[model samples]
Target: MTQKLAGRTAVVVGGGQTPGATVGNGRAAALTYAREGADVLVVDRDLDSAEETAELIRKEGGTSLAHRADITVEADCESIAGAALDTYGRIDILHNNVGIVPAGRTEDLAAETWRRGFEINLTGMWLTCKAVLPHMRHRGSGTIVNISSMAGLLAGGETIAYNTSKAAVHSLTRSLAIEYAPHGVRVNCIAPGMMDTPMGVDANARAGGVSRDDVAAQRAAMVPMRRQGSGWDVARAALFLASDESAFITGVVLAVDGGFSLRAGIQ
Candidate 1:
């Protein structure tokens, strides 16, 4: 273990995943942080899945704890932060990996569906950061990684609220970074594109009633790299942002896409 994060405590929101075909970015990041020597706090709405991630870390000789949290709820976010402090005594890295990807046209999508998209994708991230910022400020130094999406940077014909909300996340990250830099806290965002994770592949497959393989090929062709990204790809990008390697970096939106955003290119 390189121990890039030795003696640190990481709070990974949405860190529980039972990917059917591919690993989720949240789980991959949790495992990566633990492997790199940070005690991890795996927080997910799914208690069983969160426990699974925590147990895996313990089995690998890494320190970890799991908690169930509904980040969209302000009180739950508060509890999540408290849990991390109570267990680890201090917080060093906060990974906001919780989000949803419900796609629909604005006019066709139910109003509630549109609102729920923003609630989970944008509001949840904000609330969690709000809960963690106080602790990070008190510590005098900390890192926060917000996961956005390429869809945020460049949306297709129809995205309803998912794309709009993620775009908001980018703005939120920049503002937080600038505001907190004076407090010795750094904030950045990772905009992932078309990962082969369960959310990207398996979920799409089921939703479209198409074969997983078919959806995978279609997504791969859309990527300029000719291959879809994996959860590990996003995890690696996050590791850099979370670790001291990016000590001088803040308020940057680092893309984890395989040239997909470039193909879309500042549109």
Candidate 2:
């Protein structure tokens, strides 16, 4: 390993993932960070699922620990930072990987559901940053990678709540980046296209009442690359944004969509 993150500590929120044939983005980023020599703290709402990810890292001779936290709760977000500090001493990277898709059109979407989606997809992210920003700012250095979606940039999806919340994430990333730049902190967002993770495929399948295979095929067909990207693709991108390689970059929303964004154009 090149050890891009050697001696660094990373907090990967939503490190646990939905069960599926393929890995999810959070799990992939955790493993990738570990592979690059970063001790990781895996946070998830599900203790068992989080432990599963921690165990995988341990099996690979990488250091990791699991913690459970409902990020929507401000106190729980504080606990995340506390756990990372207690385990790793200092946080060098904060990877926000939690997002939810509640499929609904604007007119049909429930007010409560819309609010809940924002709480998870956007507000929770801000809280986590709030939890860790002091430490990063005090040290005068840190990196944050937020996982957004192409839906935030383009139109055509019925997932009104998801699209709007993710769009807010883009704005949030830029806002934080500029605010913290003088303090030596960097904030960036990744807008992934159709990914072939269990969450992506399984959720669509259930929503469409179709087989997973059918859902996967249709999503792949939509992408310009003729295939859906994987968790590893996003992981590598996160790795770059988290590592020193992207030291000069911040507040940028990178599209890891295999040209899908180009085909769709901007909204």
Candidate 3:
């Protein structure tokens, strides 16, 4: 069988991961794209971490490069597009997997914290899209995959900042999809639920003052699949959205969750 993304070039933003036992969504997506025969640009605010991902891909005999850019910065986002075009001469796929889970209730949340969350989770995505859209429109075809969370859809989360911003991502995806459909650009989103990523496990463990295994088990039990999802699970979903296999699909919010979202509002 032919590789789904053969001869394509993919730009995977937020490609670095937190230190933990599991892979991150961005790194996994970048690797998955490479494995399927796409040259990759692994971008992250953390230059060292980005290089680590790039090095891993190189070790696997895949073509990849590391780039540093803070998504919150407009110029940096523009540079991301520029770098990709300079390196590969064209941009085929753009996968956004950057997010932060800031815990706080609406009543107690700090103004700065809420602003920061929106800046990173929402505005950053818009900026990246803004930077890349011109190039894509010029070419008349491209694919963009934005990462969201089930928290965005489900109610009752105390993390107001995370939930609201991610929810906005859903809106952003659909809005871009319709606006750019005529230009032949497809925009889609993935909402991951109960993932066992470093951000999900390690961060939660530290914040909750519990063992990582305990945290993992607790989250897994809530999932209908009886297990928390890994980065690879989300990566596979991103792969489908970024490839021509889903050429006819767009403006979709594909949930990578394991039925957790399905149980929303139940006792």
Candidate 4:
């Protein structure tokens, strides 16, 4: 079968992770795109982690480049875009897979904590879009996939900052999609549901001071499917959005959650 993304160049911000026992969405997306024949640029604040992802792609006989990028900084965002262009000469997809889960109640949340969440979860995404828009505009075509969370839609209480930040991403995706549609650029968002990813397990452990296995069990129970999703589930959703398969689709918030949002009430 022919690869859906052959000849395309993709930049996945935050596409660096060793899984910590489970693969992260960013890393999964990078690998998926690479397997589908896109030259991928893996960007993350951790040079080592980013290189690890890049190396995996190369080992699979796929094209990839890795760069350390602190997305919270405007200059770093600029450099990420520059690095991708320098390495691949063109940009067909921009996957903003970076996010932070700041666990805290709104009533008692620290002001600094909320601000930090916004910086990495929201502002960083905006800066990246800004940095890459000119290039996409020049090419007159692009696809941007922002990774949000099911918490944004289902209101998984207590994590006020994270929920709000991801909710804002959904709005950003819609507004940008409309603005860029005429330019042939599609902007979309993905909301991943309860998954067995490292951060997912870690978040549960942090909240209850329990072991990852215990948290994983709890997460599985909460899902109607009676199973936790995986980074690969989210990756495939992203793949569809970033490829020509969704050519007519834009400004969509595709939820990769396992019916978590569909079940009414708090999760």
User: lDDT of each model, Cα atoms only?
Assistant: 0.92, 0.95, 0.92, 0.90
The predicted structure with the larger TM-score, 1 or 2, is: 2
Candidate with more favorable, higher TM-score: 1 or 4: 1
For each of the candidates, give the backbone clash count. Answer: 0, 0, 0, 0
Best candidate, TM-score-wise? 2
lDDT, candidate 3, 52-135, per-residue tens: 999998999999999999999999999999999999998999999888877788888889999999999999999999999999
Query: After superposition, which runs of candidate 4 have C-alpha atoms over 4 Å from their true positions?
Result: 206-208, 265-267
Scanning candidate 3 in windows of ten residues, the lowest lDDT window is 258-267
Better-scoring candidate (lDDT), 1 or 2:
2
TM-score of candidate 4 to 2 decimals: 0.96
Q: List ranges where model 2 is wrong by over 4 Å.
A: none
Residue 109 alpha-carbon offset, candidate 4, angstroms: 1.0
lDDT of 3 at 202: 93
> Per-prediction TM-score, please?
0.97, 0.98, 0.97, 0.96
Candidate 2 — number of clashing residue pairs? 0
What does the lDDT read for residue 48 in candidate 1? 94
Residues 150-199, candidate 1, lDDT per residue (tens digit)? 98887654785888888999999999999999999999999999889998
Residue 184 accuracy (lDDT) in model 3: 93
Candidate 3, which segments miss by more than 4 Å at Cα? 265-267
Candidate 4 worst ten-residue window by lDDT: 258-267
RMSD of 4: 1.8
What's the distance in Å from true for residue 262, model 4? 0.9
